[model samples]
Target: MGKKAEILERLGGIAPALRRYSRALCAGAGHTLSDELVQSALQSVGARIRARELRPADLQEARLEAYAALTASAGKRLTDASRPTPRHPPIVHGLAELSLDDRAALLLVSLEGMGYDAAARVLGIRREALLAQLMRARAKLGVVGLPPADAESGARRAASHLRIVK
Candidate 1:
């Protein structure tokens, strides 16, 4: 097959993961938020591919690069975006409220499924700094939007299921 076909195939394979990351980025913020970011990211990736500016070593790299680009763009965008929407979960809302560096640091590690080293590389920060930022972000998230009392019992039930059988 042709190079274009190959690229298309690679993009198709990574689409689900991209969607997941985008969803995680804006989880509970609103359904369309992630979709918008994904579209914007895809547009950027397509342009780069057409310009031959980005070279993917393999399908996975292509996916990673695409994700990196999106995360970077979204990080920048989040700062200028408006106030917290009700649809946003407490955790996701807190993330959105953070500075781009902190938000990107946390999302790249947690939502993007990237390790500390990889996230640091993407954020251009030292690994230790990234970890510290992630810690602060998580702590801030915990303090925001405490869950309702009604959810506690459900959480306990879910926790109980994790008990291992000997």
Candidate 2:
């Protein structure tokens, strides 16, 4: 395959993970907004790749780039003062309580299964800083000592009130 085709293929492979991460990032905003975020991120990444501004050596690098894009886009939206607040479950409200950095750190590491180095790179922070942010996020969410599965399940239960529309 040509270079562009290869890049497109790799992006397609990471789309599911990107969507999941975007949803977590959007939490209370619901799936529609999250899907839009994912689309924006993908477009931004694709444009950079095409312009030769971002050259991912492999799938992992591509995933990081995609994540960085999504995080940036989400940050802008979350910080927009004019945006109306949407009703969310208590769990989502808890997530919204976190600073953008903390939430991104927690989700990138916990939900996306990104390593400290990769997550740090995506957040444009040092590994130590990432750990600190993750700790704060966990503490805020009261999931400090809980296992990952338990924390995730709790979030799922809290979000269960949201009905999924086909």
Candidate 3:
């Protein structure tokens, strides 16, 4: 297969994981917030591809670019008031308190099972920077690994209430 085709295939495999991550990021499903973000990211990538700003060979870069687009538009998706109210476990509350990047890093690592190197690439940061972000996020959340207590389910429930109204 061609490079772009290959990249598209990769996107297919990772899309579900991205959706789960999105659910976690928006604090729980939020209408189709994650889908919207992924779609927006695709459009952004398409534009870049047309402009020759992104080469087919740069699939990883494209992934980063698309995710950055998703993240850039996250604030709007996170503020809708119509979504279901999520239950707040201590972890969810703690996650809510983190910066967007920190939350992304923590979720990507702990929840999504991404290695620091891969997560860092997705975040467009150096590995060391990703590690720091993870550490700070974990410290804030008060856990080293995924906590299986009320925090885990609470985070999911709380995330659902975040209505990404767009």
Stretches off by above 4 angstroms in model 1 are 2-5, 27-29, 79-81, 145-166
| Ranking 2 against 3 by TM-score, winner | 2
Worst 10 residues of 3 by lDDT: 157-166
- lDDT per residue for candidate 1 within 1-166, as digits (tens), equals 8675587566856666677666656534454766777777777776777688876656656666677777776666554555457854355566566666776676666555688887787666799999899877656665665331236575554223211100
lDDT (0-100) at residue 29 of candidate 2? 67
**Residue range 74-105, candidate 2, lDDT tens digits:** 98876534222555445556566778899899
In model 3, the clashing pairs are 27-159, 28-159, 28-160, 84-161
Report the lDDT tens digits of candidate 3 across residue range 1-166.
8776666656545555556566667654464777877676677777767677777565665666666666667756676342335554445455566778898887777675667887887787899999999778767665533343356565664334322212
- lDDT minimum window of 10 residues, candidate 1: 157-166
Instruction: Tell me how far the alpha carbon of residue 137 in candidate 1 is from the true structure, in angstroms, after superposition.
Output: 1.2
Give the root-mean-square deviation of each candidate in angstroms.
6.8, 4.7, 6.3
Query: Which 10 successive residues of model 2 have the least lDDT summed?
Result: 157-166
Candidate 3 Cα errors over 4 Å, as ranges: 5-13, 56-61, 75-77, 80-91, 143-166
| Winner of 1 and 2 under TM-score | 2
Residue 62 shift from truth in candidate 3, angstroms: 3.8
| Better TM-score candidate (1, 3) | 1
Candidate 3 Cα RMSD (Å): 6.3
